[model samples]
Target: MRYEETAQLENPRSSVSTDMMVGTALYTLAIGVFFVVFGLRKRQRWIVFWGATMVVAGAAYVVAIALGVDK
Candidate 1:
């Protein structure tokens, strides 16, 4: 039997970019708005909750970007 090991970098470079963060936030915001609109039209409580959650996620991403949060 052969065993394989995956090498991990000890010191990794942070590849965070402004464009990526903004793009993700914008996409999330769009999804949230869509859900909110459809939820309102359908009068579904769960859908509205999901919509709110997505909206918060989007806002959080934006705030993290602003706060320089990165891995």
Candidate 2:
């Protein structure tokens, strides 16, 4: 294909939506909470660490989205 066609095909904005981003953030938070609870019950330090990390990242993502920082 031509370079122009390739460039046109790479429209990043069309690849995702704001709602999708929010949904992903929410899903990540849910998974983090699940892991955290399970880790606490099972007394697993690594799982708890990972869960906390993910929870913080997810919270940051959601906050950024809310603040329009992602745009």
Candidate 3:
């Protein structure tokens, strides 16, 4: 029987890009707005909470990007 070893690959380059970060922020904001609209239309408290959470998360992402923490 032969034993084989697997090597792990790592990316030394930074994974963050200005365009990608901005796009993600915009996407998250859109999703938050959608959730808010859905919650209002459905009159669901849980949906509203989720929507608020999404907004906060999106804001945090934006801040992280601005701070260059993605690197």
In lDDT terms, how accurate is model 2?
Answer: 0.87
The better candidate by lDDT, 1 or 3, is 1
TM-score of each: 0.67, 0.77, 0.61
Per-residue accuracy of model 2 over 1-71 as CA lDDT, tens digit each: 65554444464556788898789888999999999999999999899999998899889999998898966
Candidate 2 lands at a TM-score of 0.77
Off-target runs (Cα >4 Å) in candidate 1 are 1-10, 13-18
By lDDT, the candidates rank as 1, 2, 3
RMSD value for candidate 1: 3.5
- The clash number for model 3 is 0
Query: In model 3, what is the error at residue 52, expressed in angstroms?
Result: 1.1
What's the true lDDT of residue 4 in model 1?
A: 96
Q: Report the error of model 2 at residue 66, Å.
A: 0.9
